[model samples]
Target: MLLPWLVTCLAGCAVILSPVSEGCGPGRGYGKRRSPRKLAPLAYKQFSPNVAEKTLGASGRYEGKITRNSERFKELTPNYNTDIIFKDEENTGADRMMTQRCKDKLNSLAISVMNLWQGVRLRVTEGWDEDGHHSEESLHYEGRAVDITTSDRDRNKYAMLARLAVEAGFDWVYYESKAHVHCSVKSENSVATNSGGCFPGGAWVTLEDGGQKLIRDVCPGERILASSEIDGSGELIYSEVLTFLDRDPATWKQFFTIRTESGASVSLTAAHLLFVSKGNCSGGEEAAFGSMRTIYASDAQPGQCLLTTVTGELVGQNEEGRKGVGRLSRISQVNMREDVGVYAPLTRHGTLVVNGVVTSCYAVVDEHNLAHWAFAPLRLLHHWTGSAGGHVGDTGVHWYSKVLYWIGSLLLGSEHFHPWGLADPWR
Candidate 1:
């Protein structure tokens, strides 16, 4: 009886010390334990290789065709007030890719048109065509052309759009039909319709005979004042006029008027080159003229010095009278002019003085001598066959010029030859 009673007391003590019973006891110090939370499995859709091949072709890669169903075919949002819409459905996905430069200019053209006519939208009908829709030599094949149309399709509206395209820096712009306006940027593989640099009518050119003639009246075989030296020295020389080019008035829509502090001013196209000081220096004439460089008329800035000339009477019988002396004049203003006709005359030295300002007949190349050397072929062709050279009222660029430009591209390599500006990366 004693052994059984002892065993029962020991069992009761063991039960009091047990962890499961102590945790279960109500409100002693522990609370009821919570169960672990269960998590649901992630849902995933199965990959379909057939769907991928159907969208991206059997190669499973983009074949340069922007389909209407593709996410790549979307509206371009420019920083301007207008939106450029590419209607891929209209072309039925036949259009290929377009250059970024072309797209940028297209946006600019849209903004310009919208500013003129409020709420106007520019719709791109064709970007690049691989369906043999355009001419064999069309820039569209090179991804440099775009066909645009608005909702109105009015003739007047298209005319305005063409003008705006020119102003927006398109190398070529045409009103193809009542349907669309065609615009293109310059490409390495294509020939440009117009040479880059040209001047306007009413500009004055100093003759070798100490007299000045209107640039429009100046003809081939005439001698004009030019300088071979890059520095702003008054060492004037004469160079024979090789070809006089009168561009189509409709080709140009903008001109820049560069006015100097000495009350001298000249109006010229944006691509025309002029001798400007190295930087914006407020030094004296001698200091400013010490280092001269060539820059575009559109790039000219006020307070910068320009190479000019001052006419003075002959001091001796051996010297010619009314000779121009090189002087540096600070630019007062650079304004845009829209009322001017385009004229560009190629000279033997590739440099000329116009309206008392030292300018270059050749553009694209900053160095006057190098530019003259590069165009040697065109000049030689003109000398041999006068027909291939420039003529009055001839708007098309000569075949020789196109050949020379192509050769230049070959020599300069593809990476450095920018057809749009003819800019040399090395310079």
Candidate 2:
């Protein structure tokens, strides 16, 4: 009798909350069809098509339009090397133009390929083509898509190229063909402000002062607890924060939550890297350190061991409080979340402790240490120029960043600096 009464009450509540109903019955309500309650009309002026046509012209489009002449569009030239080629440069060669964001990502993709592989050149097969080859709603029409391939012609190289393209910050990367990797960047209005792997705002970062702070509250010039070595030496160090990236939550997407067996968990972007052990067990400091590798949050799986620090005083104090001892904690779960703002504080050592878990400040690259070394020049420029505090979204690649890219290009022609040489031979 009690169960029946509860069920009837729930049914009545459901009917009341529902937007529409089939018909009213004797027991339910009245024995007649009832219309939904109409909402009060808003006090907005009604739109008139004739007025819109008069103001916007007979074409029914606004006069202020974004076109090739818009500032958001840029003309790209393959000035890096003969390795970077444009498809059909002689014909249909008006200009290789794309959105500014797309152009920047394309440049990054080309530079990454040149830096990652030896004797490999990237060929831009398509850019901003409106020759009826793509769908009407394609990003190509908006100058935000490009199709590329490598000179090597290896299918394996193409797959790696796609991965690199993703790392280079393309919004969407697809291996459209064995020969080409299709990459596209989201429009400025549709994309998030953050450019790289980042942690959600709630993640805790250890400070150099032996205190913990939210990652979003960290700022440039602040020192944070970091580690230079992965081998279980139990040696922890303090590294200066170079930049703090706080992403806008409105357009930000792609997040994953990694929960360890020890109850340590952190939510971060998919591309963010976390130190994970190769085996299932913790083999103490020596064995665990050697077996640990950086894995992206998107690729992390259950049962994988992640490197973390235990809360008691194991190592002696260095200016700060007691040092944390490194330990391997097996992962219990990896899940995706939709609502969270992202933040990342890039430290000098390229490693930071978040929510008691040891993770890399760098993303997309498996070799965290090597990636930090490769970007040393950029970090140095930021330090020297004091431009690290600039917001990624608002500024869209600060002037100092552009200057560094230009310097790298000039130094590359002279054969003075080679990033490929920095890769670890053992790995």
TM-score of each prediction: 0.51, 0.50
Q: How many backbone clashes does candidate 1 have?
A: 0
Which residue pairs of candidate 2 clash? none
| Residue 77 shift from truth in candidate 2, angstroms | 23
Model 1, 140-194: lDDT tens per residue? 6545677877755655576667666655656556666666777665443222224
Enumerate residue pairs that collide in model 1.
Answer: none
**Model 2 Cα RMSD, 1 decimal:** 25.8
> What is candidate 1's CA lDDT for residue 242?
83
Error of 1 at 45 (Å): 38
User: What Cα-based lDDT does every candidate model obtain?
Assistant: 0.57, 0.57
**Could you tell me which 10 consecutive residues in candidate 2 have the lowest summed lDDT?**
53-62
